[model samples]
Target: MGLLKNLDPLLTADVLHILRSMGHGDKLLICDCNFPAAEVSTKTTTKKHVIITTSLPPVIDAICSVLPLDYFVEDRVQYMIPDAGLELPPSSVDVKNLFTAAIKKHSDTSLSGVERTSFYKESRKCFAVIQTMERRPYANLILQKGVVGPDGNDLKP
Candidate 1:
């Protein structure tokens, strides 16, 4: 607790270290309980699968509290979409809303959709994957880290 004031308590020391160590442009994957987190994490930059015993919304809120969303990319946030091109699942929509609220102050960036297979491929390249206890289907997303200016705000071009 040493002087850290507004961050969510759910963000453990390990989680905070991971978030802090990530460089701008690195990706962080947040996935639901059903995801193959252990397997996919093996390929990530950190090769770590962090399991946080909480739901997605709070986790997103906690992560976004300190992690800036990329401004250099059109879609710094990405979610899994059904391969068949069906309507976005309810959980996915909920995740989108959560991300929207979390990043509203830092960026005007929008969330994009990646098909299931492609999403898996992208997840492998992330800095790390945080698995939440969210049971809802398609409650998975990737957040690209962005730069912070000297004054502690997002750095835009």
Candidate 2:
């Protein structure tokens, strides 16, 4: 039996370590199967690809449970938009909903949209990349880490 209670089984020791090691302002990418995670991960601080055998929503939920969202940045949470325009793909909408619900109590931060190419460029700078089994198109998101104060609330401006 695992020592951590109410933690998602998918969050293994390695995954928890990655999350715990992240500092404020560090970025974490939660992406779909087609996200080129291995290639992109090579450029991240962790230099490793962490695979979670699950869909996007649960993965987002699990990560958000422990990881705080950056309140200092305007773009604390970001989703990929089709190159054509800012309209979010169906999968991205689902991602947005889950993301918003996950961090609502911790942050009032809003989500931003990054174009396909820009998203890829920004992702290369992430601290870590978590690839999920989600097959939906544009099911990708980037979360910026925030400081959790002594009282357990995220530090806000």
Candidate 3:
């Protein structure tokens, strides 16, 4: 109730709690429709509960608006790369652009692409993963948390 009314429904109480509890450098995974989010969340070392949000873009936009992306790292945001020899789908391209624009709205960090297996492996170490109803292939992404500086800006490396 306290300030929850001001946030997006996708950013539910549990989601807000998760975000608030995360420390700097903690990673949050955004899973696509095809991703085994329940299975992955269970297997994660953190043993988090997967929060399935509305869709990829809205969830990304909502979460990115409040969470600071890790500016100290070379890559604050990372998308999963399609299998070797396979190109990213059109929807994935659009989702990537959405992520870029959302982050650019608050900070200067950009997105990087990691191999499929590496992405999944990294997901296992994340604080939590939010599964979306996005039907696009290779739409998964991970955002690392950054600290807020004295000036209320994302502290850069």
Stretches of candidate 1 above 4 Å error? 1-4
- Model 3: residues >4 Å from true position, as ranges? 1-6
- Please give, for residues 1-157, the per-residue lDDT of candidate 1 as tens digits: 5646776787989899899999999999999999999999999999988999988878887887788878888878998888875777776677767756766644676778888989999999999999999887788899999999888977777
Q: Give lDDT per model, in order.
A: 0.86, 0.85, 0.81
Candidate 3 lDDT, 19-123, residue by residue in tens? 898999998888887898888888664667655646687888888878977877897888899767888878778877876686677667667899898899988
> How many clashes (backbone atoms < 3 Å, residues ≥3 apart in a chain or on different chains) does model 2 have?
0
The order by descending lDDT is 1, 2, 3
Each model's TM-score, in the order given?
A: 0.90, 0.89, 0.89
Q: How would you encode candidate 2's per-residue C-alpha lDDT over 37-147 as one tens digit per residue?
A: 999999998896899988888788788878888888899999888887467667667766775676564466788888899999999999999999988778889999999
Report residue 111 deviation for candidate 1 (angstroms): 0.8
| Cα lDDT, model 2, residue 114 | 86
Task: Please give the clash total of every predicted structure, in order.
Answer: 0, 0, 0
